[model samples]
Each structure stands twice: as C-alpha cells, then as structure tokens.
Target chain A: MRATLALMQSRLDDSPHLLRLGRLFSETVLIEVDGAEYYLTFRDGHLAAIAEGPSRKTPWRFALRTDADALAQFWQPRPRPGFHDLFGLVKIGRGRIDGDILTLVKNLRFFKEFMALPRTAPQPEETA
Target chain B: MTFEPVTGRYLTVTVQGRRQRIYVEMAGTGTPVLCLHTAGADTRQWRHILNDAELTATHRFFAFDMPWHGKSLPPEGFQTEEYLLTTDAYIETVLAVSHALGLDRPILAGCSMGGRIALQLAALHADRFAGFIAIEASDFQPAWYDIDWFHRPDAHGGEMGAALVSANISPHAPDAERWNTLWMFMQSGPGVFRGDLSFYTRDDSLIGRLARIDTTRTPVHLLVGAYDLTCTPEDARRTAAAIPGATCTVMDELGHFPMSEHPAGFRPFFADALARMKVADHV
Candidate 1:
C-alpha cells in the first residue's frame, strides 16, 4: 500500500489536470491494505498527513468510534480487475472512507485518476 | 525486422460513470492485431509478442486493458453486461482508432479472455476481423456453467500457490523480483481474487456459434500450451476439430501462457500463421 501510495504521489506531480487544481487542503484518509490499516492524508499533490506517534491508530479508528458497524461494511473492499473498477477501491463499501463524504464524491474522479498512473515504472527523480 | 518500436501509452476512458485508466502498446505498421490478455494478467503480458522480431516486420499490434483487471476501472458491480461491456468497449475503441488511422480488418489473437473475446467477436461480429489465433482459450466445460468455481479449493489455492511456488522455482531470480510479481496481485487483496474468480466462472455455449463461422473467410488457428492447467491441449484440439477447417498446434514445454512462457516456441508457430495468411492472400 505504501509503494502504491508513493507511486500515486509521483503521478500527481506530473498530472496536468491536478496541476490546475493548485494546492489542496489536508484531508485525513485511512486505507486498509492486506490485513493492516494505515492513516494517510493528501494535500497539494503530496501525501502530507500520515499518522505519526506510536500505537498509530488509523483515521478509520475515528470512523469506527462513530459507527462501528458502518466501518465493518467498508472493510470488504473488492477491487475490480478492470481499470475503471479500481475507483471502487475508494468509494462507499470499498475502502474505509470517513470525513466529508461530499468532498470525496466530488473529487473521486481526480483521486481515481491519480491511482491509475502506471506503477510499474521506477520512481522518477523530482524535477523543477 | 526493423521498425519503430512501440511504446506503452496510458489513457483514461470513462465507462458507466467511472473513469478508467488503460495502457495501449502499438507496434509495427501494417494490418493491426488487437492482442488480448489472459486472466490474472494485464496488457503487459503481450510485450514480447507485440515486439516480436518477425511479427513486427509484418503486422501492427495493439494491446490494452479490459476494465478493472489492469490499469482499467474496477467493478461498479459484477454483472454480465459489465464484463461484456469490457470487450465491446475495447473492440469499439480499436475499430474507431483503426478507422481514423485508415487501416483494414486485422487479425485477432488472444489468450483466455483474450481468446474468449476473439471467439465472441467473431461469432457476433465476424466481419470485423480477418482471422483469429486463440491459445488455450477453449477449456470451458459445460459443467463449469453450473459449478460455483470461485469457491473451488483447487482454483483459489492453485492461483496463490502457483505464484509463490513458481517464484521459488526460479533460482536465478532475485528476492525482490519474486516479491514484485507476488505482491502485484496480493496487494489488490481478496476483493480482486473474488472478482476474477467470478469472472472466470462465466462461460456460455459459443460452440454452435463457432461452428457457423466460415473458416474460408476468417481462418481460425488454435494453439495450446502443452501443460496448460486450465485449458488442456486436448480441449484445444477438440475446439479445432469442431470448427470447420480450423488448424490446431500444441506448443511444447509450455503451460496456459505459452506466449509469455515460451516465445521461442511461439515464434515459429506465429511465423507459420503469417505465412499461411500471406499464401491465402496470394491464392
């Protein structure tokens, strides 16, 4: 998940569409990978907010505190084999989505596009 | 033998309210071939064949995604129409691109779903292409239609075990290389497994439709990987026998993915197909 997240960050830098968005606000995201949970954040085309501190509780921990059963429903993230279906990874009943649902729905396409970038290539050096 | 090498290009296409990412690798410069990938693999699997020293000299090849599998979109929901849309969308896209490029009916070559779509496209829209080369594509049994294959112990266990065991089998490969391949699918998690398992379980009687195809017009060739776990050589042979005037060849020392696993074996067989197509054109 970290590797893919890193690749997503790299692609966002080169994204023409995203460059137009300018800097984004910090939003906390909790992504579950394999069997582990992670707290991640995205803003300004960079992953600026990952959980720090020991006993790191995921952002989803907050979501679970609010609604435990709802969090359970989100855990069954079934990623589609098709490229279009990948966006389902972050959608409702897919990933452990929390916070502003409105923002997520509105900007889902941008986020999905970021995830779709070819991850097979090596992480290119940052260039001005 | 020398031509401009094809580079992989990534594009976004929106399907059913979802924006999907797809990669297309177009090589050579003649009749276009839409190379289809198998289950559990992306268009990357066609790298060797698309860049083949012989085939590149004669044909233009294009390979891309089939929705949620590769760089394409994941499922909105698993429905037959969605799966069918994946094929139809690709064919339409290829056709439109070909028309814009001013190209004619090119041959279709596929493995597994790639092969399944070759047969499907030929059956529904035969006029779209010149011929088909289906490798290990005709393994579906009638019983498979009734079975809940996703739940099958052998299928799931085998798929996971195959990756781990195969990686271990390769001594020369570095640990990172093995993990790279294994992690690619593993990271996708159980959702991908269930989705693909459901996808593979889908099979219908294209046998009758296949027989109705005019072999003289659209020459069909069947290639089988000798040790194919999913689609056996015998099944391929049977499929060929059923299709009027279709030819079958069993590639040695290979399994379900002969194109990737044994390109040396594929070269001559593919070369022979090109030759036969040329001979037919002249005659």
Candidate 2:
C-alpha cells in the first residue's frame, strides 16, 4: 500500500493537467487500508508528503477506507465491477469514504484520475 | 428458453443522395429494437444484446455498421478521403437505414455517440420511435481530458486510441470482455475515432434543446455507467432533470462501454430500463 502511494505521488508529479486541476487548493487526505493508514498532504497543487501510519498533527480533509483485498483488486491489471473504482466499491459495500464530501466532489475528476494512476504507471518489474 | 442464431447482412441505403452499403444484423421477433453503436465501433458492439435469449425473445434487434465502420465500406470517391462524422450525417444515416429497412417506430437503443443520436432522434423525430434507450449519454460535457493524442498522425491504426479506450474500461470487467473491447478498438479504421469525437466532444450539444423532448409521446430512458468519465452520472442526472419525465439510471461497476465491456454486469440495469420503458408505453 505504501508502494502504491509512492506510485500515486510519482504519477501526480508527472501529470501537468492533474497539477493544474489541484492548483486551486491544498488539503490533507487520509487513505485507510484496513487498519493501516497513510496521510497524503497536497500543498499548492503538488503532493507535498506521503507519510504512513497516520499523523497526529494534521486533520485530514477527506478519508477513504477499504480492506486490503479491495485495494489489491483495484490495483490489478484488470479489475472486475465492484473493484474498478472507489464509488463502485462503495456501492457494492466494499469501501467507504468519510470526512469532507465537498472537498472530494470539488476535485472529483482530479481524484478519479489520480486514483487510476496505477493502471497507466509502469509496473515494478518493468521499472526494475 | 432457447433462441436461434443472429443473422447478418449488408443493406444499401441512400443517405443525403449518396448510395452506401451498411452492415445490418438481426435476431428474434416481436417489438423491433434498432440499435446504434458507439463512435469508431460497429454493430458488433450489440452482439451481447442481440445474443441475449430473453431480450431477443421479446424484441427483434437490428444493429448496423455505419459507413466506413466495421464491414461497411465507404462508397466510391470516399475511399481516399479523410472521414469526419458530423451530427447531420449521423442522423441522416440512421433515418435512411430505418426507412430503407421499413422499420415501424422501432425502439432506439444506443451508447456513447450512438446514445447522443438516440437522444436527438427522440427530440427531432419523436413520432418515429416508440421509446429511446440512451446509455452513457448527456446533453453537455465540459471536455475533461485532452484528446490531442488521439489525432497524432503517427498513431494511425488506433494503437494509442486503443490504449486510451482500454483505460476507460472498468478494471473489474472480465478478462474476455476487456480483450474483446481492445479488439474492437484495434479494428477501427484510422481517423474514424477522431472523426467520431468531432460529434461526441464538439457538435452534439443538446443542452437547452433537451426540454423539447416530449416524454409522453417518446419516452427517453438514460442509463449511465457509474465509472463512465466521459458522461458522468451527474451529467446524466442533470440531463434527465431537464427533460420532463425522462428516466435516468446510474449503474454501479460499469464504465463507458457498458453494453460491450461488461454485458453480464450491465444486464440488470438494461433490463430495468426496458421494463421502465414498457411501463411508460402502457401509461
């Protein structure tokens, strides 16, 4: 999951359109995979930090939770229905999103494209 | 419980005073359903719907490949030209094909670009269709992504186009379905996708025009896939809200190509839309 966050960061860094989409705001998002947590801090449209195991200092504007199985399926080369997207997973009772709903909706396209990074990002073996 | 095989053939139709051959496939008997495929796609996109035993039993399905698409080759003088599908040409071809086939107020079903056309048909020629089922359709889209990569001269034969389309398919879809979609993408003729996008992303703006749709005479049922980025669920909902009594269904776990990418998963939503249409017809 930490590796996945790293991959997401690199993908966001590489996309100019994504950066522009997020340029209007800054926020901290928490992604909870099972019991483990990761904090993603965005400063002025760029990903500033990807800290693991949660943070006591900052309050997350948005938080999403799902099990390890759901997260793994989401990152698969090809996903099946319930595993294809965050909303799809939520609809099927496999995932949940809490905290600031407006923040999520305001940057819906940015977040959607951001989460889909793994699909286009180079595989670990390919990079190695 | 059993069904016969679907039959396919080519039909010559005159559209805008120009003669062209179109590939048409049909199956079953009862209320006729004239299906329109998405941009850069052909009648093959309707294979799942055509082959569905239950759907075929109650509905006679007709799917056709547009000119320069699928097995339907463009006519003479058009062989060397760059093809750009305009909204006028698309509507003309659909009307011409329906007229040539002598279809009587068939229920129109379409997806993506085809879906936009279905909405247009309901608006312009409401009396010509019993009801129109539009999947992944909306009035306006604020061009979310940059599609210049699709028009790159070096990316002919749809390599980059296929890759981009593959990304839109839901990752949860079956492996076979995913590969089948890729096959369709790879099979599209060069520049056909970009040409189709001209109408999809540019000309087909049915925003204020949606209120002209008569829901009582011609019921419009829109089904948008939850994962469809091009025509998001919110877009469909907004479109539905503008049209009086127009129904909208947002299907979970489905993407842009709902009918083809994951037909089995999309079946329930499709079935529900048809059921709603039937109820509307009786009303």
Candidate 3:
C-alpha cells in the first residue's frame, strides 16, 4: 500500500499545477484493503486526500486508512475544529475503521468537479 | 384513510411593470417547498418530479414559471444580471402569490439558478426555512483561471445558448426531453445568453457570504449529482465545506438535474436531508 501511495504521490507531485501549489501538508497517511486504497494527504487550505477505492479491480479489495481522527474529520463541510497538527500521525498500511462506511465522509467532505473546459481535438497522425 | 386531491393554480402578477403570470401546482400538508427553476428553464422542468408519490406524501410543493418564460410575461430588461429579477424581487413576487394563497417560509428546493436564489434567500432571511435542499447550486466558477482550453466563441458568447440550458439532462436524452431542455433555453431569448455572462462572471466573494450564513436554525443540505457538469461535484464539496454545518450528499450516476434524471435514487437522499433538519432547534 505504501508503494501504491508512493506511486500515486509521484504522479501528483510531478504535476506542474500541484507542484506550483506547493505542499499543503508535510505528510500523508496511506491505507489499502479489500482491493481499495486511499491516500489521506493533509494540506494547508484543508485536510485533503485522494482515495482510489474498490473502483480499481482484482487482488485489491476496498480498504481505507487515514489519521483516525482524520477519517472523522473528512466529511465535514468545513474544517473540523483542529486537524492541522495531526498530519504526521497518519501512517501507511494501518487500516483503522475499516468497516465504517460513514467514515469515508466523516473523514473528509470530498468535492468532485466534473466540468472541464473543452480540450483541443487530437491532430491526425502524421502519415508516413 | 382520507386522501385529498392535489390542486394546481395559475395567476398573473406584475413585476417591475411586466405582467408575469405565475403558474403553480401544489399538494400535500406540511411546510411548503418553494421550487425554483434553473437558467433557461421554466417551471415545468419540475412538473413530473413534483408529482412523485413520495414527495407528495411528505410536504407541500410549489413550483412556478420564471419571468419571461412559460406563462410568465417577458420583462423589458432581463438580459443583464443587474436588470434581471433578483432574490428579493422573486421573494416579493412569491410573497404576493403566497399572501393571496396563504403560504410562508416553506423550505426551498432549487436547482441551478434556482439553487443560487435558495442560497441567497437562506443567507439573507435565515428565519424563513426549516431547511434548504439545493441541488447542484452554483457556488461560483471552478478553476476559472484555467480556461486556456475553451475556444468556441459561440459557446463562450451564448451563440450556442441552446446548449446551455439549466438542470441539463443529457445530450442523448429522449426527443421530448431534449426538446424541453432546448425550448427552455430558447425561451430565455437572446437575453438568457447575455444574462449567463452576468451569472457566470459574478464576484466569487458574494458566494463566500455562505461562510457567514446564519440560517437562523435552518440547516442546509446540499444534494449534488456526482456527474453534474454545470455545478460539478468539486464545487459542491467546496461549497459544503465552506458552510458551518451544511450536509453534502452526492447522488451516484446522476447529472445536473438529479430529480429529473434519477428520482428513485434522489428520494432517500432527500428524505435523509429532511430528517437531519427535522431535529429540534435546527429548523
């Protein structure tokens, strides 16, 4: 799971936008179980994380882990009273609150944005 | 068991000197839910959804035509957001009708543009609602600075206004649904396009006011569709996160108009929202 988390991190860390944004939090906790893996990354604006749950297939069942309180703080519309200092406490491969469904939302209020500005159409392949 | 038949009504009211007739269909017994239509759509977008058995069993529902569309009269200066009907203006219009019909402070259930007004009303007159259900309410634009990809002048300029109607269903929806969505946009006339620029470009901080929203005791539940293109789930999450105690629920596989797109899935979420607000003093 740590390896998966690291792999995901490398990808996001490589993005220019995220890099430009700087690290919101110093460290993140990664959890994987039941074919699901979630990375709870803490950052400045709020307690932010990325979850790649059971949506992925095979060998990886759905499992999630975060700073215990981090899971409780996630679904809150606004930041909980105190979630900043707890960033470093989150660890990899520790699946606390595994069966808790509300824990997903209880930990973070995940907002998904679907709209994208139309992208340019791919040009025709150069014919040899 | 005593069953009462649902009743519907229509009346013409004058707003800013324009004779806009409001058509209303309401039934049930409890606090009312004032339904607002989205951009480029009329009241009928809510027509079928309102008739659902579960909704009727819970509370009274009132849906009306926005000015210049459906049965309402076309106002003179609606193109500009400044000139278009405002939260206060609509409240006044509804007040007159409600006063005539005897209604007040019903929970607001709005989508898209209607959602904006609901948020506005909740912020301004917090005492009015027991709770609010805003479906895909526009909380402000997302990554507005990242528009390097958009290039269609018409899409930007409202030339393809037909494509911009509110509470959107889907491109491949049945013909009748498509026509309804298209007609809603068309009914806005050229003004709808002009009005969108005003809507989409409004200051973001105005929306930030929700951060300070004291909804009296009324809690707000954000019912956002996971796949909503217009409002987007990220916007919903961000907006919900901004509010103090707002509960955010994202319906799966649903689009901008969850009520129309997936009522069966939306009912339980709606019920849960109402239940959350039903707690003491949270009204």
Chain B TM-score, all predictions listed: 0.74, 0.94, 0.77
Q: Which regions of candidate 3 deviate over 4 angstroms?
A: A1-128, B1-7, B12-19, B76-100, B142-159, B164-179, B203-205, B280-283
TM-score against native, each model: 0.54, 0.71, 0.57
lDDT per residue (tens digit) for residues B1-283 in model 3: 9644546677777765666667776766665777777765667667655766666777777888766556665555545433344555665665555555566667778887677667776776666566677888867764321221122332332213443332234322333554555565555544543443345445354475787766447788888765455676777888888778887887754567655544555567777776666652443
lDDT winner: 2
Candidate 2 runs further than 4 Å off: A1-128, B1-4, B145-148, B279-283
Instruction: Give DockQ for candidates 1 onward, in order.
Output: 0.02, 0.10, 0.02
The candidate scoring highest on TM-score is: 2
For candidate 1, write residues A21-92 as lDDT tens digits. 425535665554443555657776565655532235444322211133333232223111111122222222
Give the whole-model CA lDDT for all candidates, comma-separated: 0.54, 0.79, 0.53
Q: lDDT tens string, model 2, B68-158?
A: 8899988779857877888788889999999988998888899988989898888888787889999988886654334454555543446
Best by DockQ: 2
Ranked by TM-score from best down, the candidates are 2, 3, 1
Which residue pairs show collisions in model 2? A79-B171, A79-B172, A80-B171, A80-B172, A81-B172
lDDT for position B207 in model 1: 66
The chain A TM-scores for the candidates, taken one by one, are 0.53, 0.85, 0.26
Docking tier of model 2: it is incorrect
